[model samples]
Target chain A: MLDKTTRVNLLYDHYGALLTEKQRSFVELHYLEDLSLGEIAIQFGVSRQAVHDHLRRAVDQLEQYEAVLGLVSRHMRRRAVKRQLAEVIAGLPVDDDQQRRLLELVGELCEDGNGTGGGDGDV
Target chain B: MLDKTTRVNLLYDHYGALLTEKQRSFVELHYLEDLSLGEIAIQFGVSRQAVHDHLRRAVDQLEQYEAVLGLVSRHMRRRAVKRQLAEVIAGLPVDDDQQRRLLELVGELCEDGNGTGGGDGDV
Candidate 1:
């Protein structure tokens, strides 16, 4: 299982745009910027309670989106699968040109967490 | 670009759960079940305009979610990448056990669209 901060960061990457502007700001400030609740409250000119509420709601909303869509979970699974694939390729008896090329392809997909393939149009 | 029906179906797959019950029902009825708007409204005991409004809003919401998350887009790209990976493996000079195994792995990932990997736990 992923740690809370890492999980929230991954969730935010997948569903942050679905959040309200204030909620988005609060999460970015608190999580990404590593700001404390009091600091965020002071920065946003809101009470600490309000900031806390927004952060909690925003995180809850992110988790809710994950629960429904499962995009984040799928992404993690794909990454893991790609890693296993690379391991299998590496275990082949001979490390020839073909093996090297195949490993390169696996590396590309593994690095491309979103699977854009560097916009090569020939993935 | 995908056709309207295909695009809507893909979007619906990614974001259908985020929709309200009525919107979900209307979309499933119209798109998945091949029911007409008037038919849906009559079945639900609502006006045709109301059903149409719900469908329009629901599809719009799905598109909005895609715009933010891009899960559908990434999924298509990943599928394409897997296909290309398979082709590369097939074209290898030698047809050995390792080559066959690599192709099988690629085939597994390709078939598992949501990347669950058949619950094998090894993947």
Candidate 2:
């Protein structure tokens, strides 16, 4: 049986792109809907191992797609930076000048890529 | 030295929230900007091991966050489903009735989780 964490990760990695209609149904029933593999197998009229194999293959394909495209990677990075900026903003002492400067920096970082116009140098 | 795959995965998992400013900077320079660990260490005036440790800790934190909260997992699943839908649409033959039904189903799935109101049943 796949652990919840692994199943969730696999879904995250490929839920929209890598699965077929049948495979997608399998994963949704098994993971998001919290159905057992055996139940899914019964529903789909397949063996438990077949369901497991489909999920495994789907995850491998999704990982491969991510390896090539990197959209998920970029999104994750932006999220991390945003979270860090929020923390910084929240933790600042009550200095108006410092707060203004920090907020400006945060805005700059949060802006769309072209706004800064630096070639990764500022980073 | 971190493999590119693991580094990328780490960034995706925890890029914005879990890393400190310094840790975020280190990962960006190393992964996004393609800087070497030794170079980053030299620039930050720290040992290579320190950089490595920061990255390792950051990755661990990101993984922990994902384990607990699961935003990344949800995003990944949505992406995979979208990809599969695209493929199915592309591969279908030029039959109007089937095409119309498929398109409708696609629209429903792509909807913002409210319109059809079907629970895990539709899957």
Candidate 3:
């Protein structure tokens, strides 16, 4: 079974794509493989602090990658908006007029046309 | 313009969602805002090495987060697979028979059906 740290590192590496190979490996072994820092150090024949240092540096790199890209933020924002829209649709009162209006709004939001504002339209 | 370190850190924080507030801010200023180590030290009222230490630790945290959660990995994998598939479709010869086969495969891949294998079908 994968250790928590390694698994999390893998996800970050995959998404961030900015980590060094050594850093990625360190994360995988320590975090996903559930190996202790000592174990990793032993296996890699490095000091425990060295392993720790690498892990720490790797995290910084991942964070740096995200801050520059903003892809994750955009994705999360879109998800939040979609979730909010879903809630609004689900909570609408059963009046025919209200239902129709909600449906229309949803359709507008989901439309492929370029006329809608307040969206990240194609640049 | 955001510094390199700060921008990179923001992306990671937004995606990773595992960093401490201090770590995020440090990353934002250093990486995205392009502040120097010495500058950041003065601004944060910490030693240069202290800022470095914070940035390093923050990276470790972000990597640890990714290791535990495979969301980033999954997203990358999906992107890779999609890119490969797109390349294959784009490179196909103009033969009608091949076109039909390719279209069929694409349709199957895109279908919201339960029978297809080789996909991360909903569990």
Candidate 4:
């Protein structure tokens, strides 16, 4: 299973804009930037409890969007399939030069990709 | 370049969750489903002016999110690059069968993909 933080990080990348500014900021700070609730509260000039609530609400909202749309889940599955295809390409009978070039081409495609390439795990 | 509707459609796909439910509903009805403004107004029991205002504000917010984060733009670029890579794969010296299989594999990867595949020609 993916850790809560990693899952939330992916969720935020996909749907963070739907969150209120305060919620987005608190989630980003707490999850992505590794800030404590107290620290985020200080930065936002709110109580720690308030920051905690904001983050939870944001997380819940993210989950709700995912439940409704399944965008993140689909993206993760597509990325996984792509990675497996990469492995299949590696196992092809093509020579080293051809394989390297093909892989390079794939990498170029990924140059502009969202950071959805690898999954340490998923929630 | 993409038409305004195309651009907004992609934007909606990426960030519609950030909008109010009403905003999301209006945009979906008008854009994806191609409902007339009058129809949407009747469906929602609102004035045409109110529907228009909601859509305009939602579009503006989508644009703002794109400006701040560039997610839709990056997705467009990435999708473009992947298409180019697919073309390159098509050109590779692999036999016809291998090429066809690779194409099929790529298509499989995209099976669970977002509907971001073709440009049809972006905004």
Which candidate has the top score in TM-score?
Answer: 1
lDDT (10s digit) by residue, model 1, range B36-62: 999998899999999989999889877
lDDT of model 3, residue A9: 51
Docking level for model 4: incorrect
Model 3 error, position A48 (Å): 42
Give the CAPRI rating of model 2: incorrect
Compared with the real two-chain complex, what DockQ does model 4 have? 0.21
Off by over 4 Å in 4: A16-25, A33-47, A68-71, A108-123, B15-47, B68-71, B108-123
In Å, residue B13's CA in model 2 sits off its true spot by 6.7
State which candidate, 1 or 2, has the greater TM-score.
1
Candidate 3 ranges beyond 4 A from true positions: A1-123, B1-16, B89-123
Instruction: State the lDDT of candidate 1 residue by residue for A1-123, as single tens digits.
Output: 888888888887767767777787888888888999999999889999999999998898778766766667766776777777778877765558868778776654544243111222110
Query: In candidate 1 chain B, where is summed lDDT lowest over 10 consecutive residues?
Result: B114-123
Q: Model 3 chain A, poorest ten-residue lDDT window?
A: A114-123
* Native interface contact recovery, model 3: 0.00
Give the per-residue lDDT digits (tens) of candidate 2, residues A44-106: 899999988987775665454345433344445555555654564455443666555545544
TM-score of each: 0.82, 0.35, 0.34, 0.68
When just chain B is superposed on the true chain B, each candidate scores a TM-score of 0.80, 0.60, 0.55, 0.75
Per-residue lDDT value at B55 in model 2: 76
* lDDT tens per residue, model 4, A37-108: 989888878898998887888898778766654657766766676687688788777788878776775554
User: Which docking class does model 1 fall in?
Assistant: acceptable
Candidate 3 lDDT, tens digit per residue, B1-123? 655454345336333234555776777676667788899899879999999999887766554544443333433443455455545445543455644554444333322111112222111
